[model samples]
Target: MKKAITKRLATIILAFMILTLCLNYVLQVHNARNDMYLDAKNKFWQINQILKQNEKETEQVKEDLKANCLIRAKAAAYILQYRPEITEDQEEMEKIARLLQVDEFHLFDKEGTLYAGSEPKYFGLNFTSGEQMQFFLPMLKDRELELCQDITPNTAEQKLMQYAAVWREDGEGIVQIGLEPDRVLESMKKNELSYIFSLVTADSGTTIYAIDPGTYQILGCTDGELAGKSITDVGVDPGTKMNQGFSARVNGEDSYCVFTDGDSVILGITESNRGLYKDVNSNCLLTAVYLVLISIIMIVSISKYMDYYVVRGISSVNQRLEKITKGNLDTKVEVETTPEFKELSGRINLMVDSLLDTTNKLTKILEAARVPIGVYEYNKDMKRVMATGRVADILMLTEEEARELLLDHVLFEKKLEDIRLHPVTGGKDVYRLPGEREHFIRMNTFSNANSILGIIIDVTEDMVEKQHIEKERDIDLLTGLYSRRAFYRKMEELFKAPEELGHAVILMADADNLKKVNDDYGHENGDRYLQGIAVILRSCKAEKQVLARISGDEFVVFLYQCRDREVLSAHIRELLLTMKGSTVELSNSKEIPVRFSVGCAYYPEDGRDYRELLSLSDHNMYQSKRNRER
Candidate 1:
């Protein structure tokens, strides 16, 4: 009997040892996974923080550029108004140039002939042939007071920067202020790595400037070499390297690379995955070994006692749990054993009862939740509608209709694709539904490799409000005409449209002596004079045209299908003559004569499109005014 008992006891001890080892391994694996997940979360948070900081710095830089440009534009306007003769006066030009803090200030005649600048040699040099000149022509034609151009000068010595505002004084020719590119970059530098800086053409991704001042690395080709090269044309190898993980070692150490394609910027950070994994493995191994040792000692010491008091009791409790798991929650464990076993069985039965009650309550709550909730299985070939709750009532669809809508295989498949294609975060559209309102159907997609979850929210009021806000922004509040920004938007749209059979005409008009009228009469009178000219321009338009008050006293009209320049010029001249005849009665009942200068340029004939036409017309208008003064 003693020998038989020993063999049975040995078998029990071996079983306990195996169970303890398995439990230790499971616990170690669970802890290791949790640690890795936490690490990843922390790393992602760090990246997000960096991105936010960079964005703030970039915004500050943009604000500074705007402020600087405003100051320069105002200065240029002052010089143009007070110093027309100063265009030829080198001393005056130098004084104003110093005050403006620019390398050079150039005055272009209405014909785009360089009339005067700090550099006397450039005078009379025509810029009719260059693409850069063509771009600025439209702004001048429109008499855009706050226009800015990012252009490289024809002179090789001057680097590229923004030229803000092409101003034309009543008696003076058009004046342009050149701002330094380095100054713009310097304004944006919040910290060492604040700028994701590159200089590219407005419409193309050609890297004219790509330097990291922090690293002193000419990311573009050597200075003056890659001045006009596209980002793709630069000879950086596109091959995938081994250390190209989320965080990788470059040049034998871990570092992040900020890449800019002159337009878009990307930042990549790498970490030592090998070192991370090694540390994790070591920790897990140590933890497992320690736990296993402790478990083995406990199992050996308590095997007989546990078998008598705990294991058999646990088995009985598990059998009762199995009944609960099988949907027999009414079945409870019998308490006919030792006090410890009895207590455990009682607790397990009580826990099961509580869980059942909670589950029953939850089911009732979900059933009462009237908003329709659904789950669907989506695959490449088909979309199978799986489950839905009562939220379909808001859809105004009957249960049957709702079911039919949900089950429509073709519709479901298309909707699923739409959802997959349109994300809800980061400039993505969202649809939402409010109480008993318009049925807002917003489609957005959520996805992983194998599955996707698309959520729809009905956004009825939001869409309406957004539309209203946009309309308000596009319309000018002062004169009830199209704002300058709106004009630019329309121009962009027109330029993007398919080429028509005939040419388009853009006419730029400026109110003559409006500032002098304001100074002599009052601002209210000045406003009336501007409104008067706007009325005349609006009256002259018969075709589908955009009449916009771009600035203080400047207006632009887009004329479509107009071929006769003489007819347009005659009409403009007639309007100007009428304006010269018309007078604004001020608060003191003093009549002030209203006069305006008009310039016209045709598409493809004068220049290609809006920019070129505007430039040509502006140049011509200035020339006309200059001759009139002479």
Candidate 2:
């Protein structure tokens, strides 16, 4: 092509300006719409990251549920050791099942025979009955043993259950509890296709959809209106290779679309292309007229002013538009020499802003909805910490501390080590700040020689709730006594004191007629019998005496630091005298006397261990009962 020389320099400049605007507008329209599909791909990647995180979270939640199962098993064992009335009471055990949030609750005797449970049909089942039952055989032998099973089908009903078992601390029997995995099932729901769609963040006009690979029907869609519609119904060609970007008539409008490779789910992204180029198309006629007018005016004004001011402003505006078309949207047409040029610059800037504001909007959405964690980088080469968003908040650092931590290499290394464990709770790989208030943090790091990247998560709410729940679990609600767990904890702390610890005594008591009271009256009246004894013992309780109902018909007392054996005996005699006339008020308004057999074994005198002393006292009480019967 031959270059045409303009008779006037103004016409030559006018032609160049016209050519620049046309090319700028064309590139802006083509590239801006293509970006929508790219965004879809990135959004899909983000969704995959979220699902992967959910998988890890699901495993953690399952582990927590298992620990909960163990705690519940221990609780059941505690009740059986202390509440004898429910030993063979199927109705009572069923009530306990509800209270413990369990589907099945069972108790096994020393011989590994299941004598009782919430379900009466399972009574008389033995450890040798099935593999599921046999799992507890070790618990029968090792009284300190604890065991839990994975999600598996139960022996009889074949229902999927998670079971945990613990041997009674008193060496009586095994207590077990089962759950149906409701929490785990709920967590598994996050893996669904519909759930993945919910997590996706996409462009304003873009519609993300999951289609059945066989039927090509929409399984799930971000655009609610397109749900249940087939690809053909949306004006998309079923035979088209959708991974490549193409123009199509989607829902009566021209759109740019890209789809993933087909699988059980085929994901596709579609965004209207018409509106993206509407500004360029609508301004074409105006631009043509402006070009003609500019030629006429430039031919008239041929002075140095026109060459310097007019040409310079036009060139500057063209440069900005070039940058804008190349995706530098922040570039503004700021030429301001002449009124006409200034007004033109302002309108062009506004046009660019209107066309690319979706980028700005999407950026804002991501920044605002970001969650508790933030990406943190440990630049090993620089020995500096680099973080974005709320990493400082997750790390519980102030602006000053965060700056210092980033600046000081030794501090950064120490901070890394500090976060590797909980200081107060001794939990590995958990970060904790224990002070007037406690903060829990969790972070996982991946690294190369150059840097370490971490995802810092705040887990204070979970840790705090666990601590609170444990406090609530340490006491028996019915008797207002220390729960079996609390009782043992207290006893252990005392026993752990120095060896110079003075003489103590262990007293074991059994409700001699508790079973008869339940049979003659009701379990309600039987509870009253236990309560009556509890009140009597509490009234006789002196300083340093730890009392707890160890099982349905059993109670234990720890008398700490007695002055002498005579004093301990006198205290026991006083307790027996106090309980002599204690009575339970029955539902019939009848008052019945509470009769119980009591025995005592001195600490260091009877045996060295609490369990051994308990066994000796228990034998002595039963022996006295046998002698009295004779």
Candidate 3:
């Protein structure tokens, strides 16, 4: 492990060092070539300045020759008009040309034909004979026009010469003179770029060129082989770019090239890359040696530190983890050599301790929850019910049976089927086994996605309390009989079996002396008298009898399943005789006989509306009370 870590770290260090070296090498090479490129560009600019100056000097010399040529032509024209004898005298014109230091002279008549000149060669040449002589044609009509032309070949001999012409002073004819242009030729020779190229100095492998801007023609070159050739033939393209440097093969050798434009020339230079970066490569080689030595020292130092700190600390951590994974959770990680490792160790310990704490809390909670409350979850895919231990106890299963049920969902459902749905007190349903004294379990089930989750709670106490509350709601507290609402509900249920309602009677009885008893002997005696009437109503009951103390002093009896209406009336008469026998002993130990005003309404004979039958019975009860009072 230590070797792997160290090897990986060393690989990273070497990669970074190599990357740095490559970047440094590239930067140095760029700077070296840039220095040479800038120098060549500067030199091109110097060559342009020299070419411009030469152009200005050449222009001044050409202007001097133009004036000299015009002055000589005017002198010869003055002579031709004054000395008319020389009009056709070749010898005299020749002598006149010699006197003016000119090369030739000519005379044209008004017809615009050349009649004579110093070098006539028989002399019948017209002004239209050559392009050079056409300039004086316009002078024939305007004698005031004087013209001097640039140096060119004459029409007769095609010898290079400068010519100027004017009409004879008297308009007799035109006189023209020609000169050799010796001074202008001499000035241009000195201004030639070839002469300048010879004077340029540069390092070895560098070349200088002067090219014609219009033709891309190489006018001059320091390497003489390129002279007088098109720039393209020498692998140089004199493009529109100026005063910029670029890299290319020039003369089939890799070179740095720069170009600039002069007045009438393209000044350019090329330098070899070999000499450009020589010192840069040698310096980089030395730097690489030093970097290698430094890298070796750094690797050794880092490896030693790894052996002591990182490797040892991680080994201890791994050992503790191995023990914990094997169930020795008491093992603690305590490596503290470095802050990073120390934090890692503390986190591992805390995580293990948290695992144990969570397990303990869950155990205690499961133990506490299983007795009174249990959970059973089932999904179709699961083979067994996931349940609490209390579920088995609630189902009255032994340990072995519970285990079988937990392992097999089919067995669990079969066990559930064996439990009976029994009717408990107060009309609520509870679940138990088919045996006496079995604990009641309330089933609250939630179902979704073909799965049922039943929360089983031992609600024995809750059911008992609920029954007590229901009894209070449905029973009269004073007389322990059904209240008015319960009595009516039972009557409605009884009427659902209409065949049994044929002989049924609804009897309403009022204690005739209850008000008097309450007034003379306080309300305690009134309550006892009413309770005695409830007893009498309960005494003579038929198979389907319902008794209720409905109000302060009224008791109701529903006697059904009798032989006929007459038998129902006989049942009521027996109830009245019981009421007469029934009496209450008051708080004062005074005895009061329970006398009741009894009235009956027969069902169906009184038309089956409970309120109507109850109304008729109450009316009959008041009539009986009136009769007793009389």
Candidate 4:
């Protein structure tokens, strides 16, 4: 009976081992294939995202160019309207040229003849030969307000022709203002690659402009030689025929050429797919090795027990042991064995049973103990926050002092506002807990019909460490004020607030002749001068205002709740005078007075918002410097 039992146990162990090996092999193969497929899919998605981002950037560049063109056109129109007498004057032409930053500025008569221009050669000349003339004559006849046409003056000279109608006080004949194409396209081409750009005439199948420098072997054309060929004539599949604006390969190995115009297509061919399998293969090998090691460990552990313990034990005892392993603690081993072995096995079984019962009890206790949890309440639309925990807390507080203290905290409203999105549960928030300085406060959000849950955890240490790192990041080592990056970030946040109703006054002040100061004072004194200026600006600003030393000698102050333009101007002048009184003592024991150029701009009056206001303020500051030089 013992031998038969031993044979039966051995056969069972052998069969189990074989089954485990087979299952492990199948699982590993499946996992490897799945990983490879997922890796490929991720790579494909990454490429798609990159392409989308590039496309977005390109569109933005185009929009910027269009906006710039409109501005230049409007400026030209303004010059002609306000200064009609200077329309035929050379000095006035130079002024307009300088103001517009154009190479050439021209005034055309009703008869398509140039009346006055920056170029002496164009004076008293007719512009009726090139493609620009073809686009210009029709506009003059139709009395068009503005027109942008592309023209190739010669085989080597291609220009963008911008012309806007200039109506005089009487509104009789059109005075056309023209700018060179190079001035507009120059800056754009410097940043955006022109090789991927193609200009095609909309009505005709004519390639007006093509910048592809490489030979198109697939289309049987050489560089600079594919200008006149029809897009369909090339090997590229017609996007119009496919009824899609853009198309890419299914394998994502290649991107399809884009037909931006009816007449031409722009092909942006990317690099070849090499080393594509490297990451997938590496991951597969590593995972396979890990699985094999784990399987070996599991097999050895199972084999050891089967040979030395379970096989030698009686059938009833072995059955009880299996039940115990499966978490059945009620079943007790009945067969008697040697005293030492029996004691050891019996103790282990009892201990496991006790642990199981204790685990269940603890789980129930934890479930019951969970309390004081709150969730965000949203309106019917679910996008806007109707009420939150912080709001509820404020309402609950009968005393105004208690509410005021909590409201004064930096993250008070922001934390609650963030919870409105129910982002904490989705791994969005990192906060610090009260009274637990070392611990961090973490919250996870859960949502149902009426409210959203914020599962809060203590995360104090994390918040403190993060604040320390942020302070280190924002503070400049040299001047000890906020760095340029910090200033920009703060400005972005300030301007982004929709509730900011007050007129924002921005003052840009720069130390006069900083380079000369640096050269004469050996940089050490220059450093002192910069620090002195930073201190003056910081001291001059009110408590609510933001002061930042943006550059080596430049300081930016954002006056949040200033009275009016005149009041803000007076404040700036006063600050400048105050700065003038302050002095920096150099190494030579000589006092150097601070000199600065101040320029200010107001929101909604000087410009629309922060970006435009900053630009206008910067322009005004430079203008002030120029005036001082004069």
Q: Rate the local accuracy (lDDT) of all candidates.
A: 0.59, 0.77, 0.77, 0.56
CA deviation > 4 Å runs, candidate 4: 1-33, 73-100, 110-112, 118-540, 543-630
Clashes of each: 21, 9, 0, 13
Candidate of highest TM-score: 2
RMSD of 2: 21.6
1-630 per-residue lDDT for model 4 (tens digits): 555655665666566656765676567545544543454334334434444565666556555544555566567767677677776578777887788875556666667676776666766655465554555566456654555543234211344444444433344444444445554454344323232332211111112222232332223122345555544344444434332223333123432322221122233221112222334445556656665676566556655655655446666676777766553444676444567657767786677667556435544554476533323333222233322233333223345633442333323346455434433232346532233234344455566775444444434445567779989899988778788899889888877873573656888888887788799988998988888887787776454578878877788888776555666676677787888688889999998887888788887687767778778888889899999999
TM-score per prediction, in order, is 0.36, 0.42, 0.40, 0.37
Model 4, residue 350: C-alpha shift (Å): 8.5
> Which portions of model 2 miss their true places by more than 4 Å?
1-7, 82-85, 90-103, 110-113, 124-145, 152-160, 170-172, 199-205, 211-218, 223-243, 249-253, 261-265, 282-301, 304-630
Give the range of the ten consecutive residues with the poorest summed lDDT in model 4.
199-208
User: Could you give candidate 2's per-residue lDDT for residues 25-102 as a string of tens digits?
Assistant: 777676766666677688767666767877888898889879999999988888877897787677888999999989
Prediction 4 TM-score vs. true: 0.37
Give lDDT for model 2.
Answer: 0.77
